[model samples]
Target chain A: MARTEIKIGGFGGQGVILSGYIIGRAAAIYDSKHATMIQAFGPEARGSACSAQIVVSAEPIAYPYITTPQIMIVMSQEAYTKFSPELAEGGILITEEELVKTHNLRKDLKHFSIPATRFAEELGRKMVLNIVMMGFMTSVTGIVGVEAMRQAVKVSVPKGTEHLNLNAFNKGFEYGEKLKSGAA
Target chain B: MKADPKGVVAGAYFIDGDHACAEGAIAAGCRFVAGYPITPSTEIVERIAERFPLIGGMFIQMEDEIASSIAIQGAVWGGKKAMTVTSGPGFSLMMEHIGLAAMTETPCVFVDVQRGGPSTGLPTLPGQGDMMQARWGSHGDYGIIALCPNSPQESFDLTIKAFNLAEQYRVPVLVMLDECVGHMTERVVVPPADEIEITPRRYWDGPKEGFLLFKAGPDRVPPMVKAGDGYNIHVTSLTHDERGYPVMTAAAQEKLVRRLIDKIRLNSDAIVECREEQTAGADVVIVSYGITSRIAIPAIEQARREGVKVGHLRLITAWPFPAKRIRELSHHVSCFVVPEINYGQMVREVERCVAGRTRVERVSHGGGAVHNPKDIYAKIMSCGKEERK
Candidate 1:
C-alpha cells in the first residue's frame, strides 16, 4: 500500500501540532492505518513559525520523517512559502486564505484555499482555525473521518473544553464539505 | 511487527521524546530516577516525575546534576535499579561523579540528551556534539557503555537495554539522546508490563557475616550490601583495593584501576552493538547514529533504487565504537559515509576503524539541523563514481 504524508505549518499558537496529532491518531484509531507525527518547535514557540509532519500508511512505517509531502496545509503566509517548494507533483495543497494572501502553487497540483480564521471567528473562537483547516483536509483527502478526528482531539486536548472544541470541529467539517461540493 | 517479549506492542500515540524515554526507563524496571531539571533535559525529569509516582517508583529532583548523579549512585548501592537523565551541559557537571560510579562499579543508567555545546551553546537545538564527550567525558582511563536511541520508541526500549547492560556488567551505562529525539513527538507502542525481561544489578546472596562491597568475585560484579545490612560498606571515590578501602600505594592503585578498567574491556565482545542495513553487497556504506540514522535508512533505499550499491550501518550503542564491524565492512565497501549533526565527532571513530583500508568521508552539519538525505545520497553516488575510476 502507498504511504501518504501531510505537512502542516503555521506560527506557534496556531495549533499546528495539535492538528497533526489529530490526523495521525484518527488514521491509526479509526482507519486502522499506521501513522506517525513529528513536530519541530523553535525556541520562540509562541512567536516563530512551527511545523509538523504526519505520515499515514496502510503498512507499518519504518522511518517517521516526511522529507517530501503529498499533502500540504499552511495556516499562515510564512508557512505556505516555507513548505510550498517541498510539495510534489499532483500533490494537494489545502491552506487558509484569510491569513495567507497568495501562493505560487503548481498548475497541476490541487489547491483548496479556505478562510479558516473567518470560519473560526464565526464560531466565536479564532484558535479553532486549526480544526477548521483539518476538517477541510479530511473532506478533500478522505484520509480520516471527522468523528475519528473529534475523538483523537478529545483524548489529547486538556480536559474541560471538549464540547466547545467538538462544536468547532463539526463547523469546520461542514465548511470544508460545502467548499468541496461547490455548494458554498 | 514481531511481538517483543518485553510486553510492549506497537500503537500510535502522540508523546514527546522525553516522556517516551521516561516510560522506557520505567518499563526497564528503573524504580529510582534522580535528576535536576536542565533545559531540554527537564521534560525527561518531568515525565519521570509524573509517571514514577503512578508506577509506584521514586523521582527525586535534586539541587544540581552532581547531586542527582550522587543520588542515583546511592540508590543503586541501596539495591535499586536507578537512572538520571541530563543534557550536554549537565553531563559536563556530572563527569567527576561519573568517574566515581565507574571506580565504584555502580550499575546505574545516565542519559545525556545531547544539545549544542562546549558550555551551553544552544539549550534547545539538536546536535550529536557529545559523541566524543560521552567516550572521554568522565576522567581517567575507563570503559563505559553508551547507547544512542534515534526515535521516541527506541528511546523507550533502549533505556531498558541500558539498565540491563549496566546491571550485567556492573558499570554505569550512558543513554545518549540528542535534542531532536528528546523533544520530538511520535507514535509509540508501549508493550504490556509482563512482556519485558528486566535484570536488576547482581547482588550477593552469600553469607552476610563478612560481605565486602568491592571484593573481586567470579562474575566481577561482587555482591553488594547496603549500609544498614549489618555489613560495613566502604564505597569510596579514591583509588582503593578490592576491599573498598582507600590505598595510596602505587601497586595497590594500579591493581584497583586495572580491575575497574578490565571488567568492561575484557567483555568488549558482549557490549558492542551495530545495526546493519543492506550491507552484504554494497559499494557505498552510510554510517550514522541516533535520529540521523532514521533519515539515512530511506536515503539508502533511494540510492539502491537509483542503481547504487549503498548500504547503512546505524549505531544503537555509540561508544565502545563498533571497531570490529567497521573494519570488516571496510574491506568490501568502497567508501564509508559518516553523517552526523555535529561538525565531525563520530566520523573520527569510523575513520579510525577503517584506517587505510577505505576512504572515510563525512557529511557533517552542526547548526541544529539534521543532514538531509539528498546530500548524503549525492555524496555516496559521487563516491561510487570515483571508485570506478
Candidate 2:
C-alpha cells in the first residue's frame, strides 16, 4: 500500500489538529493522494492531551484511523510520555526541545530536537508550534512538499487568518533550513 | 421455476451493513446527506461523501449532530430527499432536532447504528441500548417510523423504505441498525437504480392562490414545495393550522397535532412489517429484530429440524410495534421467546402484546456482545417444550 501513517500528538488546542488536517488536505488536494484525518481529544479542548492521525496514500484509503504510526510528532512533554511507547520501532520522533524536557527515548528511534515553540514565539505567533513541526516533517521526511503544505494551509485556514498562517509556515520552513545547514 | 424480475436482483454480494445503508439511501433517491462522524456510523458519512460528490448530491459534515439534523431539514426544504446517520451518543445529541422534525412534519431519514452507550461507554463495540430511546428519545408525544434491519441487504432495503415512508407521510423515519448489523461484513446484492422504486417529495403544482401549508387536501400529506419556489410554504415548530401560521389557540394545535399522530396511526397496518416461519400451531414463538433476529431465525430453523414446533417472528419494522401480528401469533403460541441485544426493552412490548395469555421470556445480552442462538434454543426448549409439563 502507498498509504503512509503520520501521527501528531499534543495537549488540546496546540494546533496539532490544524497540522494533521493540513497534512491530510495537502496529500489529497495537491498530491492527488487519498487522505484520512482521525482525531481524538479529551473533554477539555485545552490542557488535555490530544492526538490526530493522518493517513496519505496513492490508493483508495480504507480504515481512516491508523492502527500503527510511522512518524510521531510530540509538541509537549506530556504528549511525548503518552505517545512514545506507541511509536513504530525505528520510526522518526520530532519534538520541541524547550517544552519536552525529559523523554523516555528508545535507542533505535531517530529523534529530531527542534525549538519549534521558540521559533513560533520568535515569529510572534505562540500557536504556530504545529505549523513549524509541519514544516520540519515535510523537510525531513519529504512526505509532503513545502509548497503543497503552504497551499494546504492557504485552502484550510479560515478567511482572515491565511496570511499570518503562511508567515508562520515560512518561519517554520526557515527553521528547517537552519537545522539542515547545522547538520551539513 | 422461473424467477421473477424483482426477486432476481435480490442475490448477495460481500458488503458491510453501513455501506448498504448508504447505497440504500441513494437507491431511495436521497440527494442530500448531513452528518458528523461517530463510530459505527462514520463509515456511512465517509461512503456518502465519496459517492455524493460524483452523483451531484450534497454531503456535508456539520459541526455537531444538532447542526447536521438542521442542515438536513434545510436541504429537504430545498426539495431534495435528505438523510443523516449517527451512533447512540450522536443520536442522543440529535433528539432536539428530531423533536423539531416531528413538530414541523419534515420528511427525512435518521439512521442510528446503535452502540454501547449512556455516555461514550464503548466506541467500537456493539449494543442495542437505544431501542427505547429511538421510540421516545425526543421530548414530546409524537410519532415516528423506525425500521430494524437484520442483515446488510435489509439495511439497504429498509433505508430505501425509510425514505419512501418519510416522503409518503411527510414525516421523519429512522433506520435503527445495531452495531452488529452496522459493522458486520456480509454479502449484499445491489440492484440498479431503475430496478428500485423511489418516491420523491410530493409538491403541489397548483398556483400560489389559497395555499395552506399544513392543510391536507385529498390525501393527509400536504404538498410541500421547495423554499425558493413561489409558493409560501411556511412550516414551524409552533402550533399551526392548515394556513401554516402559528396560532396560540388550542383549536389550531388540536387539529394539527392530531393529524401528525393520526397520519401514521391510521396507516400503521400498511406500515407494519414482519417475517414469520411455521407460525401456525407452533408451541414456541421467538420474537426478535435487528441483529438479535439474525440469531433467532437459525435457532428456530434448528428447532424445527429437531422436530420441535418452534416458530420465528423477525420484525423488520419495530415502531408501530407490529402489534397485530404479535397479537395474532400470541393467540396460537403458548410461549414467546424475546431475544434482544438490550436488557428487556422490546421484551416489555412483547409481554404487553402477549399479555397473560402467553408466557413471555427474555433472552437478553448487551454491552456489545450478541446473544448466541444455542442459548436462545436452550431457553425455548426448557420453557416451551410441550412434553416438559
Candidate 3:
C-alpha cells in the first residue's frame, strides 16, 4: 500500500493537532483513504513545541508513527529547527512565513511558505490559521481534494465558525494557486 | 440481541481510541462505570462522564483505583452492565477485585490502557508490560478473559466483545490497550445500533425460592440473579458451593476453583480469536498483540519482499491464550519472533506454546516507544535463516 507520512509542528494552542485532524478526516472520511494521526503527549503538549504525526494510505496503516516525514509543516521556529533535519529527501516543507525564518534549507527539498496567521487575522479570527495552512497544504501538494477539504472543515469546526473558516481556507488556497502559477 | 437504538451514536468520526472505547461501552448497554481517572485512560472515563448523564447511566469518580474497581462490581450485582477503566498503576490496585470478580462469577468489564511501568513509570507513554499481570496479576489460580486491541476501531469493537465475553462466561474480561493506540486518532465508524449485537446478561428467571447462585448452566456458566431478587444468595471470595455459601473444606475449594479455571480452559475455543496470515509453508511466524502486532507488519512485509516466508499470529484475545493454534502452527513453522513494548512478557507464552518444536526469539523494548520496524526486520532476517525441518 502507498503511504504518505505528514508531520505538523507548532506550539500548543496554535491548532497544530487540529490541523492534522482536519487533513486526516478529509482523507479518511471524504477522500476514502485510511488516515491515522498521533499527537505529541506529556508536558510538551501543554504549551510548547507540540506536534502531530499523520499517515494517509490506500490500505490499512500499520506502524503508525513517522520515522522521517515525507511532508513537514512547521508554524514555529522551534518546530522548524527540531523537525526540519528529519524531513525525507525531496520532501515538501510548509511553514508559517511570519513565525519562522528559513535559512540553509536543503537544496533537494521544496519549500512552501504561507502567512497563515495573517490569513486567519484577515478572516477576523486568528484561531483559524491552522485551517488556512491546511488549505495551503492541499493546494500545494494536492494531497486532498478542494471539495473534500471544504467538507471536512465544515464537519470539524465549531458550529457557527464554518463561514469564517471557509473564507480563511479559500484565501490560503487562492494564494497557493498564485504560487503554483509562478505569479507570486 | 440487538443494541438499544438509543445508545448507539451512529456516525463516522475522527476520534481517539479512548473515546471510541467509551462509545463502545455505551453501545454495549453498560449503564454504570466507576473510575479514578489516570493519564491515557482518563479520557475514557471523561467521555463516559459526559455521555452517561444524558443517557440515564451512572459514572462515578471514586476516591481511588481500589474504590473504582469494587464499585463496578457492586453495580454489576445490582443488575447494570458495568465497567471500570484504569492504566497500569490503577490496574495494579484493582488486581484483588479482578480475582474477586472471577471467584464470584461477576460479569463485568475492566479496561487497562497500559503505560510503561514497574511503578507508575512513563505515565503518558505506551507499554504492554501488564500483559502478564492481566493473566496472572491477582494471587491464586483463576481464569479470566482478556482482549488486546491494536487500533482505535478495535478499541471500540473489542470493548463490546469484552462485555459480551464477560456475560457469556460470567467472568471478568479485560480490554487491554496501550498508550499509543489509546491516544491515536483515526476514522472510527460506529455502526447503527440495530446492526450491533449485544449479549444480554445471563440472569436467572427461575422461581426465586431455593435458587442456586453458583449452579452450573449447560455451558458451565452460572446464571446471575440480580441483588434483591428475593432469592437469598451469598457471593464471597472464599471457596463456596453452588449455594454460594462459604465452604472451607479442601473438597469445596477443589470443586469451586477447578470450575472457575475450567470454565475458561475448557471453553477456550469459543473465547479465543487470533488473526493468522501466511502460515502455510512459512519458515518463521511473528506472534504479537495490541499495538505491537501492528508495528510488526512493516517488518513482516519487508522480509516477505526479500523472499522470506514469514507469517503473523495477532492475538485479539490474549488470554485463554491461543495455545492450540500456536501448537498447530508450530509443527510447520521453523521459528518464531515476538516483539512487544515490554522487555519480555507475552513472548514467554509464545515460547511455551511452541514447546521447543521451533526456535523463538524476542525483540524486546522497555516501553517509551514502538519497535523500529528495521530492528524487527533485523530479527526476522535472522529467524528466517533458522534451519527448517
Best-matching candidate per TM-score: 3
Best by the DockQ measure? 3
Better of 1 and 3 by TM-score: 3
Q: Could you tell me which residue pairs clash in candidate 3?
A: none
Per-residue alpha-carbon lDDT of model 2 for B1-389, expressed as tens digits?
Answer: 12123322343344568988988887777879999999888888888898787777889888999899899998888888899999988999999888888888899999999888778877777788888888889987788889999777789889989998998888899899977677654446677555777776788888898887787854567778888988876888888878778899878877887787788888889888988877788888888888787667556767778878887888888887888788888887889888887788988889888888879988888666667678887888876555467
How do the candidates score on chain B by TM-score? 0.93, 0.94, 0.99
- Candidate 1 local lDDT, A1-184, one digit each (tens): 4888889988988998888888887887666787778777555367677888888888866567787899999988888777788988889988888888664667978888888788788888888888878777878888777678878877866687677677777776777788878898
CA error at residue A24 for candidate 1, angstroms:
2.4
Query: How many steric overlaps does candidate 1 have?
Result: 9
TM-score per candidate: 0.90, 0.66, 0.98
Task: Please give the fraction of native interface contacts (Cα pairs under 8 Å between A and B) kept by each candidate.
Answer: 0.38, 0.00, 0.90
Tens-digit lDDT track of model 3 for A12-57: 9999988999999999899999999999998889888999999999
Q: Each candidate: what lDDT?
A: 0.81, 0.79, 0.92
Better of 1 and 3 by lDDT: 3
Model 2 misplaced regions, further than 4 Å:
A1-184, B1-13
lDDT ranking of the models? 3, 1, 2
List-wise, what DockQ does each model earn? 0.46, 0.02, 0.89
Residue range A8-79, candidate 2, lDDT tens digits: 888887888778878876776676666666556235346677888787777755334465687888888788
TM-score of chain A of 3: 0.97
- Residue B380 of model 3 has an lDDT of 90
